[model samples]
Target: MITKEKILENISKIRVNKKITQKSIAEFLEIEQGSYSLLERGERDLTIDRLLQIAIFFKMDIVDIITYPNKGSYNKENEEDIKAILQIELKKDKKDQVMKLIFGDNSLEILNN
Candidate 1:
């Protein structure tokens, strides 16, 4: 499951890791710093379109924004899958633990990417 706090933290981490300033991100997104700050602080909720733009800017998926798995209106099977992935991603253990739990050997592709 993804929370606003988690989303904000991950976004901040990505920005810092990439050595991109908030102003740079704003320029890329063509949004004002005030507006961007609100979004970062979770004081403003991003529309789906805006969210899509942000994800594209970061080369990330919607999954990264989600701090927690949300079953929402999904069917039982989908809900179960989300739950499983959440457990795998959230569980803190050795590096291989996440890979083994989430995708078994399928994470090899992710590593290469």
Candidate 2:
């Protein structure tokens, strides 16, 4: 079963990897830093909306955050499948916007060329 502790651990790892500070995240969430710290330490319960916001801030799926520190091997195929589904679900303009943000204007140029 997924635990709050596991989710927080994943959030911490992702934050560190991305060089994002707790204060920055707190600012984004419009919450007090202490409250954010409490959430990170598992001292406070996280709401689903808050979790979703965190996932969006990290540019990750909520499932990835909740399923962190997986015991088994990573499932690349499943991840790819999910990505494919998301791409199909998103509208063309929105998809292009997301792709530009994730990649860059140069990526769009490459695609067009």
Which of the numbered candidates is closest to the native, going by highest lDDT?
A: 2
Cα-lDDT of candidate 2: 0.84
| Tens digits of per-residue lDDT for model 1, 1-113 | 55667777777777777787878778788989878888877788867777777778877666654532342344545665673333424444565677866778877687779
Q: Which residue pairs overlap in candidate 1's backbone?
A: 1-67, 1-68, 1-69, 2-66, 2-67, 2-68, 3-67
Per-candidate clash tally: 7, 0
Candidate of highest TM-score: 2
Question: lDDT (CA) for every model shown?
Answer: 0.69, 0.84
Clashes of 1: 7
TM accuracy, model 1: 0.51
In angstroms, give how far residue 6 of model 2 lies from its true place: 0.5
lDDT of 2 by residue, 1-113 (tens): 66778888989998998999999999999999999999999898988999999999998778877876452345666775664334256888987887788778776876777
The C-alpha stretches of model 2 lying farther than 4 A from their native spots are 69-113
RMSD of 2: 12.1
What TM-score should be assigned to candidate 2?
Answer: 0.60
